[model samples]
Each structure stands twice: as C-alpha cells, then as structure tokens.
Target: MLGPLAAGAVFFPGLFLVSKGALRVLLGWSEGDAVLVSTRLVSSLQAVMASSAGWIISSSCRDVMEDRHWLTEAYVLFATPYFAYDVFAMFLCHWHKQQVKGHEEAGPNGGAVRAALSGFLRREVLMVLHHVFMVAFCFPASLLWRRGKGDYFQGVLFLAELSTPSVCLGKVLIQYQKQNSVLHKVNGVFMLLSFFSCRVLLFPYLYYAYSRYASIPLLRVPLVAPWQCNLGAALLWPLQLYWFTLICRGALRQSGRRQKPPGS
Candidate 1:
C-alpha cells in the first residue's frame, strides 16, 4: 500500500508540474488553457494508473485477506487519503474558477469573490456532490467500513474512474475552441462510450464481483455494506446518469443542434 501511495504522492505532483510546463513550452497554451489541460491530464493519468495498478495487484493477490497482501492494503490506504485531498482541492479549484468568472461578469467593481462565495454551489453542485461522496462514502469503504475485509473489492470500484479522463478531455476540447477539430469529435465519442462502459455498464459487475468472491449473495450484499456505503454505491448510477445527460448535451454542440449554457 505504501509503495503505490508513495509512488502516487510523488508521481501526481511531479506529473502535474511537468505536464503544465510541457503544455506551456511545447504548445504555448494560454495560462487558463494550460492549467485546465494540465489538471485534466493529471487526473486522467492518475485514474488510469490507479485502475491499472489495482487490477494488477488484485490479479496477483488471489485472496486479499488470505494472501495478506500488504500491497492491496497500501493501495487502498494511498487512495483514501489521496481522494479526500482530491475532493477538497477539486471543490476549491471549481469554486475559484467560478469566482473568477463571476468577477469578470461583474466587471472591475463586480466583487466576484463575494458573489462566488454567496452562490458557490450554484454552478458546482454536482461536482461538489461527487467529491463529497468520495470523501464520505468511498473513503470509508476503502479504509474503514470494510477495513481489511474487502480491500480487493474496494480496488475494483476504483476502476470506474477510468472514464473520467475522457470526460475531462471533452470539456477541455470545448473550452479551448477545438469544437471543430476531429479530435473533439473523437473525444466526444470516447466520452460517451467510456462513461457508459465504466460508469453505467460495469456498475453491475462491481457488485457482482463482490458477491461472487465474498460469498455474499446479490440481495444480501447491501445488508453487509454500511448504509452510507450503499447510498454511495447507489448514487453512482444517477450521478453518472446526470453527467451522461450532460455529455449527450455536449455532443449536440458539435452538430449545431444546441448551444451549451454556463454551469452545465
């Protein structure tokens, strides 16, 4: 656990700085674009790395408690704290971004910071909710709820994050005025398909694996989960569904069928 985490702790920050510099140096992106793109790149890379590592570790473990794999435990430990930080940082960034935008709308005297603080969640409710769930439900599941009981299962759930990069890229494409590029079209397709596969389709597998391996029946698995855990798991579908709706809406932007509004 410490190994992957120490690696992530080191890797995430290093990558963020490197990617930000590369974007500015190689592509000459504007400050806003560079920050946005670099952040997305860091998120995508981390999700991919986490998911891949979880799978590889699980494959090697065969039995988490029985194998007594410190590796899986370390991974979960790493992820729990990292995600809590991610949730906090993500909310702050969104808030600040919205605040700055508000500041712009109000002109030089608009008091955007005050405006943003007063109506913070007006634009970031969903993102805020998602991160809150991460800190509340997912963190506990990974660390305390099941504790050592289902570390492997907790890792499996992490794979659902694999689609997030595509989602971020889709937004980045639109933000950077690449709406007409073939890359945008390709990213849109990936955003839709990957979100469905990881967030929608594979949901059942997440539970099914838990049931099959844990010897807990499908109907009874929820009984074992902390009530909050079940809520967290149940919420995943609807939240992703909501984002999927947004993805569909964004896809329409390419076709000139609709224009996206702010805070979407």
Candidate 2:
C-alpha cells in the first residue's frame, strides 16, 4: 500500500515536470501554457487509469456487496496521492495564469504568493473541498469502513472519473482561446453528456444495482442499505448535481454564442 502511494507521489509530479519541459521544448508553448496543459494531461491520465480500474473491478465482481477485488484497495491507495498532488498542481496552474494576466504584480516579499494563493482558493474552493473530502473521508471509507466488502461499490465510484477527460479538453480549448471553435463546441456537448451520465447519475445507478442484486425495489434499497453507504451518497449526489447544472449552463452559454451573427 505504501509502495503504491509513494510511487504515485513520485509519478504525478514527475509526469508534470517531464510534460512541462517537453511541451516547452517541442511545442514552443509559454511556461504558463505548458503548466496548464501538463496539469490537465496528468488529470486526464488519472481519469483514464481510474476508469480502466473501475471497469476491471466491476467486471470481476459477481456480487456487488460481497465480492472483493485486489485492485479496489490497491488502486485507492495508489490514487490517494493524486488528490494531494493535484491540489499543488492546480495551484501552480492558477499561479501561472495569474501571472500571465498580471494579477500578481511585483510587490513586498511574499505578498504576490499570498495573493495568488488567496485567489486560487477563492476560485477553486469547491473543487479543493471536493478533493480534500475524497482523500480525508472517502479514502478511509473505501479502505477501512467496508470491512473488506463492497469492492464493487468502490469500483463503480471510480467510474465517476470517466467524465474527466472531456472536462480537461474543454479547459484546454478555453486556455488556448478556442472556445468558439467547432471542436470546443463539440467537446462542450460531449462534456455535458459524459458529466451527466457518469457523475450526476452514478449514485442513483449504484442504488439501482444494489436493488437488482438484493431483489428489492429501488427505493427500498436505499432504506435498507448500510447507513454509511446512504450517508455517502446523500452527501455526494447533490454536489454532482450542482456541478452538472454549472456545466449545463456553461454549455448553453457557449451554444448561444456560437449561434450569434458574426458581427455580433
């Protein structure tokens, strides 16, 4: 467990530096541009790894609550570092963007760093909170609270990352000032679809799966489910719905912009 965790600590930051340097040399992108893209690239890779692990664990399990897969706990431990790393990566990305925008001007010692950190927290408070919750709460729940059961549930939760690549692509397009392009528009639609299906509806699907397995009605499944499971879903589902609505609104705004007259 510690080995995988330590490896992840090394892997993500190492990948970021290597990717940043490669983008700077090979693509001639600015430092800010490279950092932003490299961070998103790392995120997309993590998402792919998670989705793949989810598929493997889900497919291997016959009983949703009783079956265990080696990858379930192992992947969770491996991924734990990613959340911590991403917070720092996100801060780096934010700092670079702020510098590009001149939001951080030369000032008293440490003043610029403090301002950048404040802005980052303000802009990304929800996302930062989400990552923190995953590491602090969800980590222990997956590893300890289940008492070695419900690896299938952990697998399904991992599938929630399936939407991340599209999300990353949308950010990349916006970063390059290409949000008006056809590809960005298409990716916006795809992000909406993927985010809705994979994130927003995921918890309900979990309950439905449990219902099917337990031979109970869908509504009844929640009532009889373990309190921890119910509490976790209750806490997470609303956040997913909130993010989905934000994505939907953003997509609508982009669609509206795309439909306007050229001069307008």
Best by lDDT: 2
Residues 46-118 of candidate 1 have per-residue lDDT tens digits of 6886788667666765674444445555665565545544554454456546645655442323465556545
TM-score of 2: 0.94
lDDT for each candidate structure: 0.67, 0.90
Which regions of candidate 2 fall more than 4 Å away from where they truly are? 103-109
Query: Tens-digit lDDT track for model 2 on 1-264?
Result: 798888888998899999999999999988888999999999999999999999999999998889889999999989999999999999988888778787554343577788889999999998898899889888998888989988888898999999999999999998889987889878887888889899998999999998998899998987898888888888889999998988888888877887898997
The local lDDT score (0 to 100) that residue 60 gets in candidate 1 is: 62
Q: Candidate 2 has which clashing residue pairs, if any? A: none
RMSD of each: 5.1, 1.8
